[model samples]
Structures are given as structure tokens and as C-alpha cells.
Target: MKPITRYLGVFVCTALSACASGAPLSSGKPFDLTPPKTMMADGIFYSQRAWPGTVPMQVAIVEIDLQTRGLSFAVSSGRASDASEYRSQTTSTFLRESGAIVAINGGYFSPVVSAEGLGQDAVGFAKSNGRVVSPASTPQTAGAAKAVVCFDRRQVQILAALACPDRFANGLAAGPLLVQDGAIKVDPKNATRHPRSILGINASGNRLWLVTIDGRQKGYSEGASFAESALILQALGAAHAINLDGGGSTALVYRDPVQGPRVLNRPIQGGVPGTERPVATHIGVFTKAKPKT
Candidate 1:
């Protein structure tokens, strides 16, 4: 079920129907591996999963073509108290202010890997003039003004959380994590999703690598592990990739399948909720560069 097809179904009814209509047989099923078309525009690339599935929460993954431009990532809490606010914070506010297009949910939490820091040990070092200074002394202290910014650089970035005590103790302790450059396959004793095979794939014709957590979630019945999702992204030609926020918060929005640009994925808790928690980040897609006019 391609996203375009599923999104087409949503426009005809309330967005909630998109999820309710699918949950009967698809609540626990994963998407099939049928590669979908990809397009690039306005410094961003857009692509949807080949198969259709309900996310049951708010989330998205977007790749900001930062090959020649600078980029940054941050998380914030809003007054509206819903997932849409988080998406707007990244797309309309954070990204707009900094001119960064790509964003995702959930900031990577770690001592050295906070949204405001460098790599675990700086193996593939890149120069940066501006620093992502901490907005608060602690994560609990972060507020609406809190954010993380990445200085100008040309590398497939990795945003991940440490699942173990020594997730990145040494330069190579991060695990079998796939980055935009390549796969840093590391074995961990405290594997969070141990016994579950993950899928890995290189995107952007192998320029980006995308990894996903909670592959066994409903829409990913075909996905039993993160590795499986990686393969999906790889088949899509991601050069380097990493997992974003998944589970109940995994939502994807796109243009209307039958019409035009519209919300493509279902992102709500049980299809109803007063206010959703503030997501750390989000992902938004746009067209590739425009022709000279």
C-alpha cells in the first residue's frame, strides 16, 4: 500500500477513518516491499513507503538536501500541546528561522550526542564555526525556546539515542548503526531490541542510510526488527540513514494521492486524544531545486 494510495483514501473521509478502516486486518501487519517513486525539489527529497499502513500517532522522516547548505536539529515543547505543534515548531518555526528543511521526531539523547553536541568521539571530524550551545542545563529544564543546531557541514548526519550504558563509550562503541556515510555495525550486550533482526538500507542512491526503531509495530508487520526497515530505506536508495521516532508516534504526511499535497499517514493515539506530548523533532518534505526562471 503506497502512501499516495492510502492518503487518497484519507481525503475522502475523516483522517481518523484512514486509521480505523485499516486496523481490522492491518493493525498488526507490516508493509510490503514495493519500491515507490522518489522526487527531489527545493533542496528536499520526497518519497513514501511502497506499502500503506496506519501509524496511529504523529511522526515523519524528511531528508534536507544539505549537500551545499548548513543544517541543525533541535526539540521544543509548545503551548498547543499536540503533535501538530511539534511539527510546526520544526517546519514553520525552527527550520524557517534557520532555513533548515529536513527534521524528524525525538532528539538523540546522550552525553556527547545531545542535539547540541558533536559525534561520540569525532572519528570523521568536520569543522564548525557555530556551536549548538545548550539551552538548558538539563533535559527536564528544556522549554519552548530550547533547540539544537548543527553548524555548516557536508555529511550524512546520524540522530540516535544510546540504548546501552556504553553505547558510544569508545569511538566504535555506538553499535551496528548506519549513518549517511556507511554502516557502523557494532554489537551491544544490552541490546534494547535484542533477538529481533533489523533491516538496514542505504538511501539517496547509497548516500544516506535510514534506520527505524520498533519495526514490529503494526504498519510494519513485514518489519520484525529495525534491520528490516533499514532494507526498505536501502531499497529506496538512501545513502546513509538512521531510525527516527516510531511506535505510536510514527506519522508521515505528503501530497494528496488523488488530489495534490495532503496528509498521507495516520498519527494519533488510539485515534483520539485531547493533547499529545511534544515531540523532540519532525520531518518535512519539499520539492527539489527549481529551474532557473
Candidate 2:
């Protein structure tokens, strides 16, 4: 795909800086849910918040309007002939190579430590541009991989893996479905916290949200549990959401017209800050060029 010629200035904000103001978290916690410092474009908003709780957390978010005329989605495609065979690349690389305005790491996969993320297989079902890149996993293999989000043009829907249709324009499976029907669905007993990547949509499914929470670094951003993640999405008004591949693989990248592509969150791979792990799949978002004024 050709890269977008029209460039937009992108800004990265820290917890201390003031940005635009939005609705506070519905939980009523002291979360500093400020609006984005700047709008990336029409229908795209970027923002960050500092949650000074028992464990401090930093979050990055990109909300896109599905109704945007030129909005489209792409999943990383591998060169392997075998659907199971997969290669990994950093989220930023996916963004640049795909010419997407926004990119985020996708579904869980077998870990591959190489810089290229080679010799890896997607842990669950994955499809790219109507091709089944990876098949669905049995519950025995990945219980969390039971939920899937399907995309067809500007329309999106979350479905159980078993309920997924035989055909879809694009889709990926990753879960422990975080939210459904405006309710949190993660196991309450599960309290494990790590850096997380989440995809969510409003009840109307016309708005899409991509979120990343930085974690594992003490005194900075400690991370969030499954419940906490769900709550954050709920606060942002997501009626349905799913957890994507996270931890060291948690990465979000944005294309700045001038700076090219850049990582939005501080990704920690192998305990090193700013390190990006190669992952099996990524979701890239593209927007059509704006009309000349």
C-alpha cells in the first residue's frame, strides 16, 4: 500500500502535561483522564493519563471513528506458505511498512526472541484481508483465545471463537474477553498485572479504541490487572473490548507526518525500556487523505 502523503503533527504527552479534557472515568477513581493534547486528525484522538494508585500507571490511547469515510484496517501478512508459519515484526515496523496512521500489536503468539520475531506462530485464530493467516486454537491450547473481533470495512463485531463466521474481511482472536454488553467479563480471581494492549468499541460499534498501558517498571508505570483494564475501557465508554497480546509485546505506534513512525508507549522487552519485541501479528489503521481546503 502507498504511504499517506498528507502529514499530521503527532504529540506524545506525559501524566504531568495538560491536554484536552474529556469525561472522567466512570469508576470515579482519581484517574487524571484528560483529553488528548492534540487531535491527530478528524475522528482520531490521542491521549495519556497518569493513574497514581497503589501502583502507578501510565496509559496511551487512540480512539478512531469507525464511521470515518476513509478508515480501514490491515493485519500483518507473513511470507510463509503455511498458514501456521509466522514471522514477527515490531509494531512501528508494521505501521511504516503498511503505511498506516496508527498501529498496535495484535493477538498472543508463541514467543520468539529475535529482533525480526521469526519462528513464531499466532496462538489463536488470525485473518488478514480475508485470508486465514492462522487457524483457531482449541480451548486446551489457549483458553484466553476464545474471543475474536471481526472487521468488515467500517463495521466491527466481537464474537466467541466458536461463533466466528466462516468468512470475514479481517479478524484476530485474543482474549479473556474484557468487556461485554457494558459489563466486565474477566475472571475476578485473576489479579495478574502486566503491560497490556486492548481493543474496544462503543455499544453502537461506530467508534474504535486502541489502548496500551505501560508496566513492569517500578516507580514509573507498574501496569494493570485484567479487571483494572476492563474498568479503564468502561470508563472510556467501551461496551465491548478484548485484551490483545501485551507484556513486553505491548506496543502502540503512530505515524507523524514529519517524524515518520514512532512508538507511543514505553515498551519493555527483556526488561529493557524502549525495547520492542517482535510479535506474530499487528493491526494497522489507515486514513484517507484529507480534502484540500
User: By lDDT, who's the top model here?
Assistant: 2
Over 4 Å off, model 2: 1-30, 82-84, 290-293
Candidate 1, residues 220-256, lDDT tens digits: the string is 3323234444433444445444444444333333333
Relative to the true structure, candidate 2 has a C-alpha RMSD (angstroms) of: 5.0
Q: Please report, as a residue range, the 10-residue window in candidate 2 with the lowest summed lDDT.
A: 1-10
Quantify all predictions' global Cα lDDT against the true fold.
0.30, 0.79
- Pairing residues by index, what is the TM-score of model 2? 0.87
Write down the lDDT that model 2 would get. 0.79
CA shift of 158, model 1, Å:
3.4
